[model samples]
Target: MSEITPDLVRHLGVLARIQLSDEEVERLTGQLDAIVDNIAKVSEVATPEVAATSHPIPLSNVFRSDVPGDMLSLDEVLQNAPDAADGRFRVTAILGEEQ
Candidate 1:
């Protein structure tokens, strides 16, 4: 099994953009080592001969056929808007900076 050391933990923290203290890195190293061991065991069981299955139960596409439906007019659609301008709904500015 691969040993996860402080260096490995620190590298992982950098990759994840996480700020960890020296003590946290030591704790995470042990935790990650155990997780890697569990994953290695899983890989051992997954052989070339065995078929990969994502879900335990059988699944089929339950979507209905695409059919054109009646659409409300622009005026009708904009009728319920808290704020509307011309023929469309007016929304509050999201960008903090005002132009």
Candidate 2:
């Protein structure tokens, strides 16, 4: 079991630039010890035969093929716009300021 003392917690708090109270230090010491113990248990079960992965299940790309075909012309695209100027969509000036 990992031994996390109050002194160790206090020193860690200083290093992290955190101001921990006596009660907080005492509480964190036990919590930190438990976390370290759990990690140690996991390490014990991990073997060279087992592979490390970010996810439990295998993943594959689910995207369609990138094929470019049939694009609309500038006139066809601007035909549906409410307002257009200089071959571009015209929008109201934001921030209540004059353009």
- Return the top candidate by lDDT: 2
In candidate 2, the residue pairs with backbone N, CA or C atoms under 3 Å apart (3 or more residues apart, or in different chains) clash, namely: none
For all candidates, what are the clash counts? 0, 0
CA RMSD for every model? 5.7, 2.6
lDDT of each: 0.91, 0.92
Local error of candidate 1 at residue 99 (angstroms): 16
What local lDDT does model 2 show for residue 72?
A: 97
- Candidate 2: stretches off by over 4 Å: 92-99
The sequence of per-residue lDDT tens digits that candidate 1 reaches over residues 25-67 is 9889899999999998899999999889999998999999999
TM-score attained by model 1: 0.58
